[model samples]
Target: MLSITNEGGSDMKRSFLPLFAAGLSLAVLLSGCGASSGNASQATASAAAYQEMPAATETAVDYSAGFYDAAAPAAENYDMDYGSDAAAGETAAPSGEGAAQQAADTQRKIIRHANMTLETKAFDEALREIESLVTGSGGYIESQSIDGQSLSYRGDYYERSASIMARIPAEKLDEVASQVGTLCNVVSRSESMDDISDTYFDAQARLETLNIQEERLLAILEKAESLEDVITLESALSDVRYEIESITASLRRMDSQVTYSYLNMDLREVLEYQKISDQPPAFSTRLSNAFAEGIDSIVVSLENTLLICASAGPVLVVWLVILGLLVCAILLIVRRVQRRAEQRRAARNASVQNARADQPPAVNIPPKEPEDKVK
Candidate 1:
């Protein structure tokens, strides 16, 4: 009984000590939380005070001193309020600026003219000569055609007429055309030039506008303040650059075309015939020529046959050694390709022989009348 009572007393003591320690820890935690809350309140108040000071200070400060310190001090000390009357003068100056602008807008027109005509005995020859002339003139033939009459024997009975379209440098148009005409007889020729000054000036103005837009876009890109703004400006700059490039390319092409002139040449070579009667071979000569051709044909045939036999001799021997085994295979494929061909022809002949062997002999009909009489 005494041991039991002592054990119970010890357990009670241990439980009471733990409850006391737990109460003390709770009290310490509450105190720290309260202190942290007070400090946070004080910091909030300090931040509010800092924010409130700026506007009050600016209002209380002397306006002139603020302004001078911020914006006007250097000008005041150095008397450096430098000014320009560009805006004022702009209204008064109606002088040469407009004329200069107009002058810049105007473009000089370059005009070129070319003409050519050629005559020859053969239209094909005339066409070839014209093509050569154009090439020699640092030009190209743009168009060409042949016409008139077909010859049965020579395969060209055509009247042999041609027209050549070509391009050459504008300054050298006349000289090139004259040189080209020397290739044949010139029947007729004409050349004309038209000035495109207005068209050129208009294109120049548009090009200038594109250039200005390009420069403006570059400036905008430099001054971009936001990511979105930068993206938008970059896209716009790309478009502007594309436009500038296209315009420049167009300008160059137009300049090149205007600097050169087009030439259209009408050429005809009459069908000149050599007298065949005068050029006829004698009978002995004809016979000799026929004999020569026959000899040539024989020689060619002999050479070809020799080459074929030489190439195929070994293959033929190897095929002969395997010929029996391959015969059925060859027959199968051959029959498949051409049913009425040689292999099928042999099979058909064999079938006819078999049918003839299987056929019975014909019998006499005298028994039919005798059977009728007995009935």
Candidate 2:
């Protein structure tokens, strides 16, 4: 029996040993794989962080030489022309150089704006004429507003006022202004010009620079071997793309402003009535005008009163309602307080009367008689 048992134990041991060995080997292999994966992940993360940084420095180093060479000529020419013009004091250039410089100067970007105020007796006619002129000249009205006030005795004809802002082509700005002047008496006219050539060109140059950087970054992204590098490059590319879009939008706006001229026009109807002179007239004239002036004054006063009431009626009603509510609330509180005080006073008086009535009356005569008898 002991021998048989020993043999069975040996068999079991042999099987267990093999199983343990296999498990150990599997664990070791797994550990090795985990270590390698961890190392790879770390490397990827480091690479990603490095790539995510701005490429300005690297881009400058890599492309500065070629970009500068390509972009310097225009700048140099512009500077030379500007310097020559400044020194020449607006005088004509001596040769072809002057003509070229003049041409360049004329090509500069400018944003023009004009403000005009006009008054006319025929308000509606003038308004229609102005609109027609603007449309005919390839211009569109950006915004317009009209206001009118009722004339006191003028029977349905309101004194009208209008303000209009229009955008006309830069080439036709002067022509449009002259045509508008003919529509009415030009009460006041003013114009201004802004030169933004330098700013516009600067923005364009910056846009080009960013575009070049974007292309280089894309190429680098393609060659990147690590996930980290790709993420970093993608972030940088997005930022570059955003800047490119913003610059493009700004350039478009500048171009629009430069191509189109802005005009602000204010139109007012001339008053039909003439003012009476302060100087005294002859006696006959004064006597005749007295009754007419008095009636006119009374009518004017009534019109002014009506205007004030129309403007302030709602506001005054709201204030009066609020004041009445406040007054009612205050009166209610006072009444409540007075009622409480009266109740307290009545209770105190009743308490005092009860105490007096509950007290015994003194018998003074009986006590004196007893005292006398005792003495």
Candidate 3:
């Protein structure tokens, strides 16, 4: 019986140990699975929460930042803000560029102006002269007016005036104005210089470009394959034509200023001299006139003589003074020459006497000796 009891207890012990081991293993496995499930749930909830937040909820983060910069390995510094500065510079550049472009466009315009006036004896003659000058200069009158005939206050005369607007070469505007002035007494004159070279060139360029565009459009219209293409070409051509017209009008105006010089004038006359009847005078008038004339002649002669003396006196005095100085100089020179001549004559006589004294006595001793020997 004891053996039986021991066997049963061993068996129970073995079974219990096995069950206990299995339970611990199962518990550990379940705990690990639960822990893993909880982590997964939390991760899922966090992801959902992140999704629920608005895009604006989080401020932008600059992820690239150096921690413990002093302890970090050396590296080249790159300024992250450079991109913003470059973008801002780019934005500012166009404003200055746009302003410069606007200034350039404004610089491309042209401008000009002129004026003149004259007075002459006849309106027709003045007009003719003005016309000829203007026409020769390649200009035409823009407008003109001639006053109707009206009796002058002095009965025999008439009053008239003319205004002519002529176009001439801009370079010759001054020349034309001066020429017009010769037709009459220049009553008034004014000249002005304005620079419209930019506008003139601008119009010319636009017109030329438009003309080219028109030619292209015409070619396109001719070669168009369909109604739609033709319509498109026609519309574009119309716009180009309008632009050309506008530019041409501007060019015409500039050309007018360049071609025509303006002249405004007034022509009139005032009688100065006229002839009168020629007749003989009476005896009393003649006698009185003769006496007055004789006295007038005598007075004029005396006055003329006095005037001549007054005008010539200073000149005469200057000449006499100059002549006196010259004579004095000549006399001084003559006196010097005479003194030199006298000195020369005295020296010549002294030299001749000295020469004769230097010579030895001749033959007298010989004659005396010969006489003594003979004795």
Residue ranges of candidate 2 with Cα displaced over 4 Å:
1-106, 150-158, 272-375
lDDT by residue for model 3 over 50-98, one digit each (tens)? 2333232222211122221321221111112323224223111111223
Pitting candidate 2 against candidate 3, the one with the higher TM-score is: 2
Candidates 2 and 3 compared: the better one by lDDT is 2
TM-scores of all candidate predictions against the true structure: 0.41, 0.48, 0.37
State how far residue 192 of model 2 sits from its true place (Å).
Answer: 0.9
lDDT (tens digit, per residue) of candidate 2 on 259-373: 7789999998876423446696899998879988999999989997998898799999999999999999999999999999999999999999999999999777753456767
Using TM-score, give the best candidate's number: 2
The ten-residue window of minimal lDDT in model 3 covers 71-80
Best by lDDT: 2
Global Cα lDDT for candidate 2: 0.62
